[model samples]
Target: MKKRKILIIGLMVVGALALLTGCIPGDGSHTVAKPAGFFSGIWHGWIAPISLVGGLFNKHLRVYEVNNTGWFYDLGFYAAVISGFGGISLFRNKKSKND
Candidate 1:
């Protein structure tokens, strides 16, 4: 019974993720006179999770800008991604040797 319950929950989670994946970064193509730069990339990276959720309901919304400054934008985006998510591990409490 426990295994069946787990299986159902797992499937639900996977289904939700599959649905959400449609809104992932770089999936949309838009044309803009002014392309996003490094700072915009940083902001976009920080708000990526929110954008993903928003994008699902709003087709116009996207996690990544289609018009951007290439390498600089990519660097800023990746830097923010690594720092924002990966930095969370830095604050975790470590187990004491006595414990």
Candidate 2:
């Protein structure tokens, strides 16, 4: 029970930190020399859950970058999003015949 409590507190702290430091999706208008690309999309997608929660309190935050490499960025974003969530199911414990 103590371990569970510590784990929960640790997770909360990590989550709070992530919310405070995670990237914010935007139009990229401020960066004229470079636009977000595939790798950026992947990173954004990975932290999207935290961003969503942060967005609720901060109106300036967004979920997707407007200025990007188009399809490549979209592909990376979708790939990460799918893999991040889908990978969890892959670890499910299957019933053994003995059980």
Candidate 1 — which residues are off by over 4 angstroms? 1-31, 90-93
User: Candidate 2 lDDT, tens digit per residue, 1-99?
Assistant: 999999999999998776644456762342546777898889778877777877788887777777778899899888888889887788889889999
**What TM value does model 1 have?**
0.62
TM for every model, in the order presented, reads 0.62, 0.67
User: Residues 3-25, candidate 1, lDDT per residue (tens digit)?
Assistant: 99999999998888666554345
TM-score: model 2 vs. ground truth: 0.67
lDDT for predicted candidate 2 compared with the true structure: 0.77
Please give the range of 10 consecutive residues that has the lowest summed lDDT in model 1: 22-31
Best by TM-score: 2
C-alpha RMSD (angstroms) for model 1: 7.8
